[model samples]
Target: MKIKNITTFLLKVPLGDQRFYSSQCAFPERNSLLVRIETDTGICGWGESGQYGPGEPVATFIETVLKPRLIGKNPLDINVLWEDMFTGIRDFGRKTTGIEAMSGIDIALWDIAGKFYDKPVYELLGGAFRKKVLGYATGCYYRGEDVLDYKKSLQNLKDEASGYIDAGFTALKIKVGLLHVKEEMERIAAIREAVGNDIILMVDANHAYNFHTAKRIGKFLEEMNVHFFEEPVVPENIHGYKTLRETLNLAIAAGENEFTRFGYLELLKNECLDIIQPNIGCAGGFTEAKRIEALASAYHVQVIPHCWGSGIALAAALQYCATIAPSPHTAFECAPENSPMIEYDKNVNPLRDSLLTETFNVNDGFVQIPDGPGLGVEINMSVLKKHLTKT
Candidate 1:
């Protein structure tokens, strides 16, 4: 089908006073950019772009910069269109916005392809390795106004950890490096104590440490039997990653900020990570992420997508998780092993949790991949309208 028009809706929903704190900053609100592509045959598809901070700029880029070039082109020529888009922003030389915009468009095209073929997006890739994927909680962030208040923060995290277990998540990722090493250790200790030994506790430092510090913190986590350590060092520091990976036995996870398949290859070639966490939305959508997964597959590295956005993004991530072969050979079986787990963001955000008439919820620690044609992402336009930030 020929492309007719492209539109973007910028959305923002407040998270109230309950701040979601990571190592770098505290976010009191969640923002997203949704891309809609309509075709001549009356088919429509959806994709989400990363404007988690400034939605308007990315939305404007999608319209002013991408629209003219896309109209009347074949919707199926995804690689050709994606290459064309890169040329449009060649002067910028790998800006995250350009890559993020390309990600949205590519994912939408894949959704269109899936609809055209009358199959789920995962089937279009190569049939599902699994029909449902387990999700890990990404909710234990510093909730108090004073983040360094370890006593309160630890109690709040312990409470959140219990909630995750109650909500049916066996695996949970908690934000760290917001306070001193001793306090952070105490926080991890409390959550582990609350959730007990069977539950998986993963720590994400969000690139908050150097080699010495990352090693020290990682050693503490290993003592607590933490599942993995995420982004302990900055993404650009390849040596730092190599050192950390070499130094620690804990599964080293990185790559959410990683841009494309090529960027991922650099990490893979060096064996810099035991698990790679690429956000399907940010790391070049399905097209590039599939390529990233293929590369990871060759290395036997696990790919647990870093999902954090609206329902559109969550839907896209679910589709991806469905297709990925459970690590080792090319199939998924319910074993208590290192397989793909969906990074379900449990932080407060209605834009992701409530925007769709048919919402995604973690049930018994797993989420069933959408069985409908395309990504199976159907949103209540009224809900979209309610959260639409007027530009």
Candidate 2:
């Protein structure tokens, strides 16, 4: 079937009281750009671009540039379409907004392909390696008042860790690098005390530290038995990543900011990271994510996707996660320690819950893969309208 039209929705959800701080910025609101592609055959699919950059640029790029090329093309030829878009923008749009726009359109095209074949996206990606994947609760962001009272912030973090455990999450990731090294260590200590030893704990610095600072923190994390340390240094510092991985006992994870297979190849060839976190929505969708996964597999690096945004992004991640083969496969690959995991942002976002007709809920530390066709989740148009903003 031929493509008919494409629609883009720029959504913003105010965080108000839920405002939290990462290492680099404060998240006062969550924003997403959703793309809907309708075909002449009456089939439609939904996708989301990454929230890394401004939504308006991504929406505009999709409509003004990519949409024209895809107007009457066959959505089933996803790879060819992806190549065409990627090549057209290779000069100016390789990294951020250009690829991000392509990501949304690529995901929607995959959704259309799956529906056409009467198969799930995972099956289209070469079938499921596992039906469900362990999910880690990604929260413990710094509060506005966190710097004012150290003791109170520590207590707040402890309480938050306990709440995630109560909510059936066995794995948790906390934010760091916003505070002094000593203060952030105390926060980690508090959460570790609250969750105890059995729970899996990870920390994301969000590229806040320099090489020396990250080294100091990495030593402490190794002692704490933290599962992974994410983005300790800036993404540009390939040498820092290599040295950190060599020095630390913990896994060094990054790549959420990375663009495509070409970008990922640099990290892999350098032996920089022990684990690579590629956001499907941002890192070229399923088409390029598959390539990233293969490239990571060759380097023996784990590929655990970084997921944030609305349910459309989450569902796309879940579908992609289903196809990831066990890294360093063993008979017990089904175990959490051996298998890959998906990041489940625990922060408040109505877009994640109310945007889809059937919301995804974590159960016993795992989220079942979506089984319906395409991304396997239906959008609630009313919720879309509620959060829609001018582009």
Q: lDDT tens digits, residues 215-263, model 1?
A: 9999999999988899998989899898888988788999988888888
Q: What is the TM-score of each candidate against the true structure?
A: 0.96, 0.98
lDDT score for residue 181 of model 1: 86
Computed on alpha carbons, the lDDT of every model, listed in order, comes to 0.85, 0.91
Which stretches of model 2 miss by more than 4 angstroms?
144-148, 334-336
* Model 1 ranges with Cα > 4 A deviation: 93-95, 330-338
lDDT of 1: 0.85
* Candidate 1 residue pairs that clash: none
Clashing pairs in 2: none
Q: How accurate locally is residue 332 in candidate 2, as Cα lDDT from 0 to 100?
A: 66
The global Cα lDDT (0 to 1) of model 2 is: 0.91
